[model samples]
Target: MSSFLTNSLKLLSGAIVAVALVTSAPALAAGGHGRKPVDPGFSFEGPFGTFDQGALQRGYKVYREVCSACHSMKLVSFRNLGQKGGPFYDPKYKNPNDNPVVKQIASEFETAEIDPDSGDEVMRKSTPSDRFPSPFKNDEAAKASNGGAIPPDLSVINKARNGHAPYIYSILIGYEPKPVGLEIPDTQHYNAYVAGSLATQWKGDPHHVPAGGVLAMPPPLTDGRVTFDDGTPSTLKQQAKDVTTFLEWAGDPHMVARKQTGFAVILFLILLGGVVYLAYRQTWKGHH
Candidate 1:
């Protein structure tokens, strides 16, 4: 009986050590952490290795002309584009300073008229303080405008949606006609990622390609609606990339600052960890 008890104790100790080794090995291998890698392809590269202002501006143009009809950017204000302080903008795009053409286009919207002190009607250009004007008078009107589907507000879309900017770009470029031998259900939408389904939640019925390949919205840019001033080919992919980048900036103007701050914090933590490790080793020098 005593021999059996001793063997059991030995086995328990070995199990504990094995469990600790298994768990601690991964921790050590990970160097105390794991982090997701940022997608580099989605990044804009210039002399500063940051977002291109020109691209963003052009993207804004595309959004206003094409996407704006279906999407509303409620969170972003016209003033944000002219902000003087933000990671995305060196000098924010604001009223008066806005491009005359862009301002003219935006001014088509009917906004509130403010009375001056003298009681004269003063029609002012829309500001950031104003809420986005709905395209339709009500939900029923909106549904009627967009077939049976409701166009979603794009204000916080970059922040709220999954797949981030890259996903948005991919979705825009991924739209294709249904292929043969695929029966998309009425409910399931077409997605390139999902297999054997049609009618996705975001788009129309799906068929072939992947599951999520079929987007409901027809290709907005089949021909050249927007030509680059630099004479770069205005491909669908380029359009998607530019617009997605703009949306990303709109979503988080401080992303660059936030990344810089995060890197600094990481470096500080690494230095602190090294110091603590050295002190711990010195204090335990007398211990085994």
Candidate 2:
């Protein structure tokens, strides 16, 4: 009897631990590589948190002025910016397509249209329905322009990376001076956030191999690179954070709504459990 009780207690403890780990999986999975990612304490981090509208808008500006030079967000349409929960969403515009701000933003870009009468392709101002155009015509062209490195699309980059927004934030501001005894090609720059494998590149002690990886791209952000209309200081960290926020929203636009639904479901489940427990107790009360 004593041994059985001990075993049962151990099993229960193990089950509890397993449940805890499972519940914390999302946070754990969002962690970074060798170097830890800095948490910017974003508004949309916790279960009940929502996207920060100002950050989203500023981030969009950063992408437009800086990142757009190389990277593309092809998955996002111009009208997405004016949709509910988006950066430029206005209550006045129920239809994102008809949103004047979105329309104006789209029209700034020239899109190719075929003239019906002349049967000739002509460059016309883009509409809200248009997707963000790629800077390069093709992958080969992008590679050629970028020294054989094709910039990854920003549309879903936050989702694609393991550390999510934090990892991207870390990378954007992660450039560091190269460590001694670590050799990399001239084309590659060192970023401390990466988990660099130095199996062939390390000339130092095997046990003390440096943490970080080589990047094909140099540091893309600088202080005051973008001036914010809201008067937010355009520091390197701020730009990184804002752009990361925008990328996060682009990657998972429905995150806040999904979290709300999950919270509702959890509340319902808890209430259901309570009701079921009460029913069970009532059914067995007299007999017990």
Per-residue lDDT for 6-59 in model 2, tens only?
999999999999999898987775443358777788888988789999999999
Off by over 4 Å in 1: 1-40, 44-49, 84-88, 91-110, 113-124, 128-133, 181-196, 199-210
Among all candidates shown, the one with the greatest TM-score: 2
What tens digits encode model 1's per-residue C-alpha lDDT throughout 193-226? 3222333432423322234544445666544677
Cα misplacement distance, residue 266 of candidate 2 (Å): 2.3
Candidate 2 overall lDDT versus native: 0.89
* Location of the lowest summed lDDT over 10 successive residues in candidate 1: 31-40
| Candidate 1: residue 45 lDDT (0-100) | 33
**Model 1 TM-score, all chains together:** 0.65
Q: What local lDDT score does residue 106 receive in model 2, on the 0 to 100 scale?
A: 97
